[model samples]
Target: MKGVYDIGGIGLTWDLAVQGGRVPPVEFSVDPRVRHSFWALVVGGGSMYMGYVFDQSAIQRICALPTVRQAKLTYALTTVVTSISFVTLSFLGLVAYSYYTVRGCDPFKAGYLKNRNQLVPYFVMEIFHGFPGMSGLFLATIFSAALSSVSSVINGLAANTIEDLLRPAFDRYNTTEKGKIFIAKISVFFFGGLCVSLSFVARTLPGTVVQAAIGFVGACAGPVFGIFLLGASTPWGNIAGAASGLVVSLVLNAWITLGGIMYGRRPVPLPPAPGNFCHVQEVANITGLYLPDPFNNSTGYIDFSTSSPIPVAGIDSGGNPLYNISYMNYALTGWLIAFLVGLAVSLATKHWHEPTRDERLLLPFVRRFWRLNQADELQQAVKLRHSGEHSVEGPQTQKRLISFGNQTSDMI
Candidate 1:
C-alpha cells in the first residue's frame, strides 16, 4: 500500500511536470451498462501477479534440496513449466486485450511509457476488471512469490552473517539455531523495509518498469556471471582477473547508459499524445536550421506537417536512433564483454591447478562414478585381507583404503 502510494505520487508529479503543468486526464468513454465488464477485465489482469508468485514457490522448492544436482534439475524443470505458463497466459492476455480494443476498450492506454502516472490507470483497471475469479488467485500467487524471494534473501543473509561475520566474533553463539533465526528475521525485516523505501526513489527514475528491472539485473549480474564462469572454466582465473572484469563491465555499462541519459537520449520513449506532437513543417521552415545557403538566416518554427513531404530525421543527442539497440542485445553485450575480459586475464595468469577434487565432490553425478572406483578399491583390499597373504602390497592397499575413506569423509 505504501509502495503503491509512493509510486503514484512520484508518477503524478512527473506527469504534471512533463505536460507543462497540464494534467493529461484519461477519460473513459464506455457505455454505462458495460461498467461491470470493465471491472472484470481489470480484475483479470491482477491474476498475472499469480504467475510471479508461482515462480517464486518453484524456486523455493528447488532451493530446499540438499544436493546441487537435485537443485539444478528442480530449477530447470520448474523454470520450463513456469515459463510456458507465463507465455500461454500472456498470449491469452494479448487476445483478451485485442478483443477489448476492437470493442473500443483500451485499458492500457496511458500517456507515457516511463511515467508511473500512466501505469496507475492500467494497474487500477487490472485490479478492478482484468480477471474475475483469477485475480485473487493471481494476487495470492504474487504474494507467495514475494514471500519466497524474501525468504531466500533472508536465508542467504543468515548464512553469510552467521558463517562469515557473527561466527568469527562469537563462536559460542554460532551453534544456537534460535539466535541465528532471530538475527535472520531481523535482517530480513530491516532489508525488506529498506528495499520498499528505496523503491519509492526508484519510481521517480525515467524508464519503463521492464527496462528498469532488466537493466538493474543486468548491471548487477554481469560481473558476477563473468566471475563464476572464470572460476568454473579456467584455473588461471585469479582475483586480479575477477576484479578487472568487474571494474571494466561496471565502467562500460555506466558510461553507455549515463552518457546516453546526460545527452538527452532517454532509454524509454516519452508520452505519445499531445506531449510529443510537433509540426514537421515548422521544424523545416527554420531557414538557418538546415538551409543550404548560409545567407538565408531567418529563424522560425517550421510547421513540418504543412511543409515539404521530406521527413526530418531527428537523431537523439547521442547521435543514434533511440531504438537502435535492443535491450537484450545490450545486456548480452555487457555479459560477453565481461566474459571475454575475464577469460583473457585468466589466460594471461595461467598458474592455478584445476580443482578436480572439489569438482568431483561438488558434482553429485560425478561423485557417483568416484564412488564406483572406491568400491572397486575396497573390494580389492577385502580380497587381499581374506587371502591370509601378508604381501608388501596388502598393507599399502589397506593404508590406501584408509586414506580414501578420509578423503571421502572430507568431501562429504
Candidate 2:
C-alpha cells in the first residue's frame, strides 16, 4: 500500500497517516514498479492544465484576427504546436520511467527523484553519460516542461494584470504606452519573484514535492477558475455573484489545507524524517475502486502492509472530528459550489442584458472578427473615395443626411 500511495501522488498523505499511527512501516523507493505510476500522475495533471491554458489563450487570439484566413492559420499553428509539445512530454516521461524500470532503477523511488536538494548531483552524474547524449536530451525535456509552465503563467498573469488592474487605473490618469509597458514588465518581475520565493517556502512544508506544488496552485487558482467559469458561462452572473464564488472557493481550499484552522482544529504533526511514507487504507476502500494504478492491483485491492498511515482528522479539544473531509476531494467540491452559487444568484437577480461594448472588446478575438466583417459590408455600399462632384465626405454621407431631412418632413 505504501508503494501504491507513492505511485498515486499521495505519498505525503500516506506519510502523515504513518506519523499519526494510522498505518504500518513500509519501504518506499523509486522502484520500477512505481515509477510509471508516479510519472503518469505528474505528467497527466500538468499537461491537462497546461493544455487548457494554451487552448483558451489561442482561442482568444484567433478570435481577434481581422480575417478568416488569419484566424484559421493562427488557430491551426497554435493548436498543433501546443498539442505536439504536450504529447511529446508525455511520451518522454513514459520512456524515462520505462528505461529506469528496465534497468532495475526506480526514478520515482523516495530518494531518486530529482528535487532541488538532489537535482545538482543528479545532473552531475548524468554528465558522465556524454554532454550531448541521452542525458542531455533528458535534461532538455525537463527544462522544456519547466519553461512551458513558467512561460504560460507569466504570460497569463501579465495579460490579466494589465487588462484588469493596471489598465483601469491608467485610464483614469491617461497613461502613455511606455508607462503601461513599464507597469506590465514590473508586474511580471514581481509575480515571478514572488512565486520563486514561495516555492522556497514550500520546500519547508511536510509533503511530497508534487503534493506541495499541487496544493499551492490549487489553493490559489481554485477561486480564479470558479470566477472565470461563472463569468464566461452565465449571462446573469454579476460581479457580486462572482466575488461570492471566489471567496467560497478560497475559504474551502484553505480549510482543507490548514486542517480546519479557521474552525479551531489543531495542526497535524509532521513525520520524523524527510523520506517517511504513509497510506490511507480508508481511502482505498471508500470508493471501492482501488484508488487506480500503480497503487492497487487489477482487482482493486492494495497491499496495506507496505504502506504507512495517513491523518484523517485534526486533533480537537475533546478529540472530536474538526472536519470529516479529504483534501483530494476539495477541488471538485469547490468548483461545484462556486458554479451553483454563481448560477443561482445570477438567475435570481434577473439582471440579464446586453454586455457593454468594452466587455465585448475584452474578448478580443470575437470583436475583431465581427468588426472586420462589418467594415467589409459598409465598404461595398460607399464609394472608394470622394468624387469632386460630391462633398468631401462623399455622396453616401450626403444621401444619409438628405434621407434624414425627408423623414423629418414626413413626420411634420
Candidate 3:
C-alpha cells in the first residue's frame, strides 16, 4: 500500500533538468556531451559485457568444467544470473529515488550524506529502523558482500603470483611438498596485506569508491583482454606484438584514468534540496523529541554562471577532451588501440614471424576459414606435383605443409 503509492506517485524521472550552461554529472539529456547521458550509460553497459567475456577468473572456472558443452552452459547461466542481479540492483536504485521523493527530502543535497553511494545504507537504515533486527541484517549483508569480493580477489592474486612468478623457482629447486604449501600460505598472507594497503591508498584517491574501483579495473582489464583477443583471433600476433600491445594499452588507459581524476572539473550543484516539509511539532509527536531543520538552509538556488567557459559535453570538468571520456569506453579504447598497434607491429616483423598453425588456438570461425584454405592449397599442391611443376614456396605454403604433416602423423 504505501509502497505502491510511493512508486506509482513519482514514477520514473531524470530529476531536474540542468539549467543555465551547467552540466550535471548525471542526466538523461539528448546531449552526447554529458558524462552520464543516456547514450553514455548505454555504451558503458558494455564494460560489464567486456568483463564477462574477458575476465580471467570466470574463464578459469569455465575451463575447469568437464566438457566444452558444460563450459558453454556454465558461461551462459552465469551471465544470465549476473545480468538479472544487475537489473534488480538497478530497480532498487529507482525504489530509493522514489522513497526519497515521497519523503520530500534528499539525503545527499540535504548534507546528511556526503556521496550518493551512501544513499543505499541510509535508505536501508531509515526504512528498517523500526524493525529491531532488519537494520542489523542489512549490515550483515553488506559485510558478507565485502568479504566475498575481498576473499576472491586475494585468492586470485595469490594463485597468479605463485603460478606465474614462483612456480619456476620452486621447480628449479625441487621444492618439497610441505615447503610448497608453506610458501603458498605465505603468499596468501602477503597478497592479503598488500590488498589491504592498496585499499587505504584508494581512499586517498579522488572520486567515490565505485568510480575509483571501476576505473582501476577497466584500465587493467582493457589491455589484458586485448592481448587475449589478439592471441585467440589472429595467427600473426607474435610475442613482440602482444608485449607491445599490452604495454601501450595499459599506459594509455592509466593516463586517461589518472588524468581525469587529477584534473577533472567537479559537477555543478544538484537542484536545491526539496523544501523543508517536516514540521518541528510533527517530529516531536513521532519521536517524542524536537528536531532542528534537517535541510540546514539547503534551499538556495544553484548558480551556474562561472568565469571559465562552459565545457563541451562529454569532456571532464577540466575541459580536456581526451581524459573526460566515459569510463565505460576505457576498455573499448584499449581494445582498439591494442589491436591496431599489434597488427602493425606484427606486419612490420612479418619476415621473421611464423603464423600459428594450430587450429585449436584460433576462433571457431577463423578455424573454419583456415580449414577451407588448407584444403584448397592441398589440392593445388597435388595438381602441381602431378604435373611435375614447381610452385614458388611462400610462408603460407610452409605453414600448410607443416600443418598437413602434423595432421597426417596424428591420423597414422
Best by lDDT: 3
Candidate closer to the true structure by TM-score (higher is better), 1 or 3: 3
lDDT of each: 0.48, 0.50, 0.66
**Candidate 2 regions with alpha-carbon error over 4 angstroms:** 1-132, 231-234, 260-328, 351-412
Better of 2 and 3 by TM-score: 3
Q: What is the lDDT of residue 240 in candidate 2?
A: 70
Per-residue CA lDDT of candidate 3, range 1-412, in tens? Answer: 2333433443332231223222245566644335567665665546536655666566667777889999878778877997798776665655665555444555665567776667778877776666788878878998898888787766666677778888999999998889877888898799889888997887677656776776678777777777778888887788888889888988888888887677754444334334334343346658877543332336433222322344443344446766667665676677777877887888788779877767799888887777666567667766765675546667776666667767645535
Q: List RMSD in Å for every model shown.
A: 16.5, 14.9, 5.8
What is candidate 3's CA lDDT for residue 174? 93
lDDT of model 3, residue 99: 56
Q: Which one wins on TM-score?
A: 3
Cα shift from native, residue 396, model 1 (Å): 24
Estimate the overall C-alpha local distance difference test score of candidate 2.
Answer: 0.50
Name the lDDT value of residue 112 in candidate 3: 77
Candidate 3 clashing pairs?
A: 33-313, 33-314, 265-317
Compose the digit string of candidate 1's lDDT tens values, residues 1-412.
2222322344533442333212223323232112113432232222222223223334456567899798767657766886797665444333332222222223334322345435433443444453475556656786797677666665655566656677765576445768767776787677778767867976766655545554454545555555655555543466767777878977776565554434434332322222112233225455435422211224232122331232222434346442333232334445556778877876776555222334432334555665666667667876776787756566656677677667667757
Q: Which ranges in model 3 have alpha carbons more than 4 Å from their true place? A: 1-34, 37-39, 277-282, 285-320, 351-353, 376-402, 405-412
After the best TM-score superposition of candidate 3, give how far the Cα of residue 313 lies from its true spot, in angstroms.
Answer: 4.8
